[model samples]
Target: MRAHIRSTSMHPSGNHIDAEVDVRTLSVALLSGTGRMGVHLSAAWAHAGMDVRVCSRRKEKAQQIVDALLSGQGYSTGQIMVPPHPCDRPAPSASWRLQAGRVEEAADADVIVLASPFHVMWRTLEPLAPRMRGKGKIFIDLTNPWLNTSAPKGPRGQTLPPIPKAEPQASVLFHKTRFNDPTSSWCHAYRHVFWMLIHPTGPNPRCGERLGVELLGDPRAVAVCTAMIKAHGFKPVIRPGGCEVAPRYEISMLGRREKGPDAPPAAGSDPDGLIGPFSASPLIAVDALLEKAARHFR
Candidate 1:
């Protein structure tokens, strides 16, 4: 699918002035930068030339991750400028800097990506809520609520655990209630469809372009989040009703039947393979999801 490019208009002053400009140089704060998914996402955004601030309990670990992201692998370190706070009267100037800081620093960023484990999420963000309130910032939730537990051993000692319940939307609601930042908004919870780790050497090592993201959030915030997803080189599939639809996605994946090694490709009308909703064309997947949702909801 073709990417959606945000449009900008130029005005004729003595100097060419931009009438409107997209937030291309978004400043992102990753609260859990040292985590597995956090590192990949932080690197991906930084690789796309955005100003990224990674936060961790240990500053050294955060700095190491940032350094690895900035290394002259295949990725280029884009220019950075310090922009004014988004809530300020005048539009902020864009600035770029690769740095690691405490959670407090994340309050000033335009975008905040939360990748902490489900159990620790609230405790981690409660203190920062005051700092983040009223910034009109966009918060992206990238957490799966399932706890890791061991299952019974199979004949080959390879038993898999049952899939856990999905509650991503509840996380978003909790954030809003605790933060209560009326000025700010949150995009839907998002998860990568593929499992490969992205790094400076190759951002999309697992052919991420062939996969897509599943998102549930406010339309406006979803649009912004979608742009960021596209910047990371994946198509984004947005479902309405915010985080409410996330459980269905989880159940679908959990209940799917395993295909034999020689199983043929699923037919267009098949619902069995709907659990993994990602596709090279995200709209089609979204349509399928909508149909499934309608049936389930009705």
Candidate 2:
């Protein structure tokens, strides 16, 4: 599955530019930098040649995470350029790939990776919506809308609760909030996929060359994110009908056995052991989800 990379070229006046946007040059901000997903993704993107900012409620926590990620890779403190202020942007001439900042400073980025827990997602982003709106920023929502009583950790290091039998379908999480804007687009990805499966240092994928990642959003935004996923070494399995039918994707992890009407068939084929007994592994759940969606929606 070689993804076709294209320029998501947007002009200042909301028109298309002929030149392609450099995936490496994209400024990415990871919200909740101390979280499991944030730690991995921030490092991954920074290593992939993107200017990444790991942002958190506490700037010190974000700085510590950034310093750790850099040190883990054998980079020294002398290589890092710590910003004097929380909102200060990295110097345009500086060559550092990763930095740390406050969550509100995420507005200065080209892409915002929502790595916060589902329970506090809206509360975290509602205020930042106005600052991020009309800025052509892409919002990558990796949060799952599980009705968890409390954040539960799965056996395989996944944050998942028991799949609820019933859930809402009226509006997808971001669409119901202030994030549904014309200038900026939101793409639902990394939801069902476990962090261990996609993280740089995690398990070696059972699937040979490509591991399918389910993506749902505007075509242009999806295309841009598809390139990003490909750069990170994962195949993008984009679902049709855009975000309108995102609710079906939201509960796809419940598997075929779920009694709820919203739960779509997990997958028509169980090639990766995704359709059998519940394992609570996102690798299986997400594989089953994208496989079923690829068949049904195609």
Candidate 3:
């Protein structure tokens, strides 16, 4: 996509820096889109009229996600054979495509969402680091490092021992290992999470109203991520400390498991009467529980 270049003085830091970004065409590539969160976000973005490329180790699973979105929703579907040259494809269209090649094919995208398992995430991303640098691309971390932990559960069914206090935040580690260089000034990395527990109910389900997203990253990166989150119809929350405070969010998930009415609804199930009433946004509700966990577990 051709980006109308504009130089802006404002950056995440107060200092003046020349950051060139394409605000008009927003394309996203989900690196591990076969997973539940990846599929949900991909479908939401496609539904929001944004271009999305779904990639996975298994191309069949990625293609299935694209087909499911087109069939499950009333969205139109089109196919374009990606050429060898990245710039040969037509301008960004509000459509979803399956990447037939490796993760390297997604490097040209404006945004890359990393939703893979924590164990394999870095291994998958390390090789792509060279292509991602200086591309002004935004990398969003949605992987929960503690996902595989088998710690004892609390009375409320919350996972115990939160992620080890010594473990570094996933986003921070990603930046240090991959994009930590003077030449990578244009690249921005973010740590973000979204809530999508509600299921489609009745003739029309307002799933967006129940879901929310939280972003913590550089100012410019957060701005791009915020716009993407809002486009998907989810409330976007920005944490002031950026990635520095990401550990708190990690710890929060272990406090209290949302259950009964407030817990996330099952896939394809109607959540109309299944969910309990709540006055606050789900992000805030979860944060509150995490705060309590920090005190109790720490």
* RMSD of every prediction: 14.8, 12.1, 12.6
Question: Tens digit of lDDT per residue, candidate 3, span 1-298?
Answer: 5223356555444534334444346677888766656665666566555567888777776776565455443212121111111122332222444333346667778777887766567678778888877666667777655554324467998776533446554444444445564432222222223223321111113233434444556655666666666554455555555555455444223331334664433222323222212322446455435544554563
Give lDDT per model, in order.
Answer: 0.53, 0.59, 0.50
Runs of candidate 3 with Cα error greater than 4 angstroms are 2-24, 72-101, 149-167, 174-178, 182-211, 256-298
Task: Please give the ranking of all candidate structures by TM-score, highest first, separated by commas.
Answer: 2, 1, 3
Compose the digit string of candidate 2's lDDT tens values, residues 131-233.
8787777778777655353356778978864333343341244443446677776667765454434434322343333366667766556666766776667
Worst 10 residues of 1 by lDDT: 75-84
Clashes of each: 9, 0, 0
Better of 1 and 2 by TM-score: 2
TM-scores, each model vs. reference: 0.62, 0.66, 0.60
Clashing pairs in 1: 80-95, 80-96, 81-94, 81-95, 81-96, 82-95, 83-93, 188-216, 188-217
User: CA lDDT of 46 in candidate 1?
Assistant: 65
Best by lDDT: 2
Better TM-score candidate (1, 3)? 1
